[model samples]
Target: MTRVSDPSAPRIAIVGATGAVGNTLIDLIEKRGFRYRDIHLVASARSAGTELNVDGESHPVRAVDEFDFSTVDLAFFSAGTEASRQWVPRATAAGAVVIDNTIAYRMDPDTPLVVPQVNAHELDRRPRSGVIANPNCSTIPLVRLLKGVEQRWGVRQAVVSTYQAASGLGHPGIDELKDASRAALDHPDETYPAKEFTPSLAFNVIPKIDRFLDSGFTLEEQKMLQESRKILGLPHLDVTTTCVRVPVVNGHSEAVWIETHGVVDRTELVEVLAGLPEVTVHDRESRHAFPTPATVDDPDRVHVGRVRVNPNNPRAFWLWLVADNLTIGAALNAIQIAEELVERRTL
Candidate 1:
């Protein structure tokens, strides 16, 4: 790593700096005024030489192959899984700790899969692998709420269905959706060729998010279960999910059914959810109570509503949540991990 005069404010590099999450990271860094000695933008060769502004300064994007990871103390990798698999080791080997925002190292024994609000303790010490893994976007919000419920009532099992937006696949997915939707409107009979989403996400919802496993669950679904278990330290946590791709452009929504060991009270449940850091809960009283992706005022927070206890079973409750997949699910989580590392002097 480059010798830093101020350890608290380390030089940082953003791999995949031209992608959706990378852009969100830049915006958050500016909005939150995250301190850093230097910032480097790195992306694929195709995006190299392009300029993107961060905190009012224009930074030319450098090709990842040409970027020197040794010049930075920390690197945030929001590139796809394959890119992360190929480059994360190089960054870590160069002595820069990596906050990987992909599924690549989440299950690795030495790399801690982190959701800052739920498992900031994991950042107290740097990992043996020299990398920290950001949990799945859908998994991030779920685990954040699960941590609170588990602590108060002891979770039994969680069943979730995610309404993920096109942005989960980044700009290409968004572009495809917009193109397909326009085509459908103009030519209702013709089919739009969809590369990002199967059967087109124009006016339909696809039940699968990622590749299907032998057991029939999509990889996205499995990520939620496995990542949740790892982050919450509940090795046998029974969290099953159905990951769906919806037509929306940005935020991801989840309908969660949580069965806890103890009886749950609605008022206290609302209080617990609302009390969590950066979470907003909408109770049943208001005229426009529940939060939707487009309607939610605060993008940084996890918005939850429709809290209902199963009448027959007091231990079971259901809730709906909306979170910005690019921010809360990706960029913000990675930034939070870095912030925790900085605060704990673990980097």
Candidate 2:
């Protein structure tokens, strides 16, 4: 196994540095104080030569084909599955430990799909393939909150409906929404753009996220169920999800119902979730007390609220959860894993 001897200062590379997640990862690495001896910004051919400022220094972005990955100690990949599929093997062969954000390897039995706060222990086995998988943006917050509950009361089943933001598709999705919104405002009857997201998304919501499977669940929805079970080590855990694309451009929100094996107590649920360092519970009787998708902007915590036991089933409870899909859900989670590797000296 290739291990990074010096945790304080390791050479780093950022794949798809021109993307939203890649940009956010650069900021988070600096904010979290992960020291790096050197940093390389890599993108596609079109994005090459673009200058990106990191920690007061301007780094020129180079095409992945032109960049050398062998010297870098750690590489964070967010260039989509196609790019990841093409470069990940080359990177691993060149001795760089890859933390992939794309779906290319998340379901691979050999690749450990992880959210550090929830399943850092899985990293003990290390990566024989030199690749670590980051869960989907929708799966991160759900699992983060479920981890504590699964530990305390043993969750038997969970159902989630996610209000995903336009940011899930990066800048293109955000731009499409904005353009459609403007067109609708200017001409109420005219048809606007429908590119990234199917069926208009400006002043509406789409119930589908990724391609639909024969099971009637979209790929994005199935990810929530499948990835949750994997990270929590509950193969039989009954999980269902419906992923929706909302107009919001920052955070993702979910209305979750969970059934535990034992009885559900509201007070105990709040205490257990609040005790987690990475979760924040904001619940009350007031109208604006619960968390909203726009409220969690670039946050590190998974905001959970509306904690209550279902009247029909004493063993079941409902929760409203919100989180920044770009940060805690993506970039920050990857950074946490890298930091964990450093602290454990496993990278």
TM-score of each: 0.97, 0.95
- Provide the lowest-lDDT 10-residue window in model 1: 1-10
Question: What TM-score should be assigned to candidate 2?
Answer: 0.95
Clash totals, every prediction: 0, 1
Per-residue lDDT over 150-202 for candidate 1, one digit per residue giving the tens place of the 0 to 100 score: 99999999999999999999999999999999999999999998899998999
Q: Which candidate achieves the best TM-score against the true structure? A: 1
Residue 247, model 2, lDDT: 92
Best by lDDT: 1
Give the per-residue lDDT of model 2 (tens digit) for 1-347: 12124546678899999999999998887787777778899999999999998887889999999888988988999999999999999999998889999889988888999998888997885698799999999899888888888888888888899999999999898888899889989999998858998888989999999999998999998888889988888888888988899999889999999999888778788888888877878873342467887665439888888888888898999999999989988999999988888777776
lDDT of 1 at 286: 58
